[model samples]
Target: MPKLWNETIAEHRRTVREATLETTAALVAEHGLASVTMSQIAKETGIGRATLYKYFPDVESILAAWHEGHVSAHLEHLTRIRDRAGTPGERLAAVLQAYADITHERPQHTEIAAVVHRGEHLAHAEQHLNALVRDLITDAAQAGDIRDDVAPAELASYCLHALGAAGSLPSKAAVHRLVAVTLAGLNLSPSTPDAAGGDD
Candidate 1:
């Protein structure tokens, strides 16, 4: 059809898809993932069943799309934080803290995770995350802020695994402490008593 008409139609479809994904996530969170249904999603999203089917084949596909969007948003958020004005060390610290907080704050939707976590998006996200942190580590190491003994990629992997513990941390304070410990491991010039004045 007309160009404007095509653009408008595309926008409308996006709106409908967004609404469906949001409604389905809420329903799954409130109820259980196993308990959610396409009919329920259609009703909650205020869209006809046929229209919902046009967007997603079933509840599983809808959840997968929602998860992919969620993961992409998270990656975008970290990119923004990394690009913000800061010294390499400062930006690295901020990124690590933000990542820890994200892990801590994410809801423990075990059922939904089991269904959606297996998608290729997870692998892509993991690669993106590793590269982002690896680049940050390289910058900070070059600046003499982070340790250079370990390879930046290896350090990035270590940070990812260490911070992953934040997901089960009891409180925000615990998460912060975990970040601090992780950062300490990366410190290039860890504090030590002056050899010339050990006892003053």
Candidate 2:
């Protein structure tokens, strides 16, 4: 009976966490990051304010949960792109493109991304992203696809900013414009453009 109670509690916690994330994302989509409230999310999730409080202490906590989900999804996509994408340059392009697509498709994620990025919590996530990007940058440099002189940390900062704001575009046409401009900073010399395409 004790084991069953524990299992039930665990499942309930999982449900609340998932529901909190969904509610936060929805509120972000409807009202933007600054407007979302823990009260609002509790109402949306059909749980009492006290129950919601038990699950997440504040609005930022909900946002943190939501951010965790987005980061996991983003990392999965990046890993797949890194492994299966063509060429080191193409991998970088694909990673950014995938990120751009996600922002456009999930405005809530974009909004939360913007809000979470306002402070040090996001800075930690940024460091993780930057390190991953640095690895890719090193590989690209080895293949002579990206400029060796540019530091990986610098490139990661630019890419993260771009990816975080990708939903700002008014239309698909703007995506190409933004991506083209961002890619231009990523080595893009005429000699490198024609390099054999394959990440392997």
Candidate 3:
């Protein structure tokens, strides 16, 4: 194929795939994961059943793509939220709060959040997010913003744990309290709140 023709075909393919993902996401949002299906996606996407098969071999493949896309977007959102505040403490809090809100309310993300927070896959995703979060933690510790007794690696592990815990919290008020307490304890500065500041 000519270069222009190939580019056009690729763009169209991307468009189709995105449409399928959006439709699948909407169904997942409204009906939950148990009822999502390739047939339903095909119908929602207004594409032929064969075409859906050509793009994704099965519902699992669609789900894999769906998860990958959600992960990419979530990481980007984390980076953006991290950038929203200047200081490491500020950025860390913002990042956790943003992720808490997302994973708390968004079903697709909440499901993947659970999956990504466990096992080897968690490490796999951490490979992409670790450096970004490490720098934030290191900066805070150096500035006496977070506690120094814990090494950066342990602190980083706790940060991931914090995001997971916040998502698991029952209420928004409760989640915020947890993040605040965790943030204070993570702060190396002695002036910060006592370890027991937030409700357990």
Highest TM-score: give the candidate number: 1
Which ranking of candidates, highest TM-score first? 1, 3, 2
Per-residue lDDT for 146 in model 1?
Answer: 87
Against the reference, the lDDT scores of all candidates come to 0.86, 0.71, 0.70
| 170: Cα error in model 3, Å | 3.5
lDDT of 2 at 4: 32
Q: What is the lDDT of residue 78 in candidate 1?
A: 91
lDDT value, residue 162 of candidate 3: 73
* Whole-structure CA lDDT of model 3: 0.70
- Which lDDT tens digits does candidate 3 get at residues 1-200? 13334567789788889888778767776776777888889988888899899998866556567667777788888888887746677676677667666766656365534533454544666676777777788887787677778787778778767767765678887776766666766853323457443321
**CA RMSD of each candidate after superposition:** 6.7, 5.2, 6.1
Better-scoring candidate (TM-score), 2 or 3: 3
- Tens digits of lDDT, candidate 1, 1-200: 13334567778788888988989888998999878889899888887899899889999888899989988988898999999986787788778888998899988899889999899989999999999999999999999888899999999999999999999999988887788789899983322224421110
lDDT of 3 at 66: 69
Q: List the residue pairs that clash in candidate 1.
A: none
Q: Count of backbone clashes for each model?
A: 0, 2, 7
- Of 2 and 3, the candidate ahead on lDDT is 2
For model 1, what is the alpha-carbon lDDT of residue 30?
94
